[model samples]
Target: MNPAEPLPRAGYADVRIIAASPDIARRVADVLRRCFDSTEQRSYPAGHDGGTRLQLTVDTAHPAGPARSWLAASQPQRADRPQGSEA
Candidate 1:
């Protein structure tokens, strides 16, 4: 199947995780699976380099956990930062 083909259902998205090794690629995909319902990942060679690419379809409408939890927890509070300072 063509990787560029559109997903069959609404709220479904195609995702590709690329890394230097298969284990690293799979670890990133696993993080997404924790946040959303996803299909089995397909592995592929990224290029002439020894990199790995993994592709899968995730259901955005059906989140396995709070999608924004990690983001929210990691962001610093506005009051804790110096006013008018550039990040």
Candidate 2:
């Protein structure tokens, strides 16, 4: 994914993982959290056989533009003042 490309500002992205064991599923979830800043939305048993299922949701937001533009837009500039005096 290109960093400069505009991303979807709304809706949730679902990520599902199936692992041989609960511990492995949890480990995968941990990696997803670190990579995408997401959290586990839910978890369950995979089926009659032994395994685990994990789901994670990533909430989308509009990208803030380049750093310099964001900073300029967010900060208010002070008015120029006379050299000698405080108002």
Q: Cα lDDT of all candidates, in order? A: 0.85, 0.66
In the range 1-87, model 1's lDDT, one tens digit per residue, is 488865568988889888999999999998999998899999999988999989999987776656757646776788767767555
Clashing pairs in 2: none
* TM-score for each of the candidates: 0.69, 0.51
Candidate 1 residue runs with Cα over 4 Å from true position: 1-4, 68-87
lDDT of 2 at 39: 51
Total clashes for model 1: 0
Clashes of each: 0, 0
lDDT of 2 by residue, 3-67 (tens): 88555445546677898898898887776565454654588989888989887775433223343
Give stretches of model 2 more than 4 Å off. Answer: 1-11, 60-87
What is the model-wide C-alpha lDDT for candidate 1? Answer: 0.85
